[model samples]
Target: MKIIVTYDVKQILTEESRASYLDEWQKEHASLLRECDHLQFEMKRLQKKRPSDQKWIADQFDKEIRTRSERMSFLDFKMDQLDQLTLGAEIHDGEIQSIQEVQMGDEWHGREQKGKIVVKDGIVQSIVPDSKGKDIMI
Candidate 1:
């Protein structure tokens, strides 16, 4: 008797199983939120100082506050994107004739030979040349 088994790559890469990634990003987002709060508080305190002192320090505080505020907004946007993000996948048409025909530790080839897809944190980061060093167009 011959038996064939298939693995669903998509099912294996779903978001539920990848919650740790989101958790990590959330921690960074929280830190940014704290930094933003601190910057705002410092700006408010600077506003109540003597006019001469404020003149000397307000410009620096304003610049720092704006930079941190922008960074916080970007972090929030990134967290939102992560919440809606999905892993990419590609389905190739190929087949293994039989278990006996399959070689152990052999590279699997699709219809066309191409570069490898780099995946990091469930995201398609980049694609570089394969062993043959052939460029694969996206």
Candidate 2:
């Protein structure tokens, strides 16, 4: 039988990758800001068009706008942390999923532990096991 597993991906910060990350983050931040502006404009227009339901409409728009605002703040925090990372430092990139085969009495964690995958310059570098001497069944 086979089972799907998820593993962590670690990225080694370099000048090239750092710049790329910054650019991507900045673009996302700008997009979210623009979305908020558009939503605010729509909220105003709706309120003016329907004064009787103005409060309800405004509340609905505020909820969505609040969600986006929170996300933007989180992005800013991430960008700041990225800026503070030293070159060559490993950072948690994301995760990857893989399928593995297993049999009866198989030690799942020992044999197929979801370890860390190291990357540099957008390329895979190495895979590290969580336990020493335990090989990852990649």
| Model 1 clashing residue pairs (backbone) | none
**Model 2: per-residue lDDT, tens digit, 69-126?**
9989998998999989899999888998877777898765554556678888978888
Q: State each model's CA lDDT, in order.
A: 0.53, 0.85
Best by TM-score: 2
Task: State in Å the error of residue 127, model 1.
Answer: 8.5
Error of 2 at 107 (Å): 4.9
Task: Quote the RMSD, in angstroms, for model 1.
Answer: 12.9
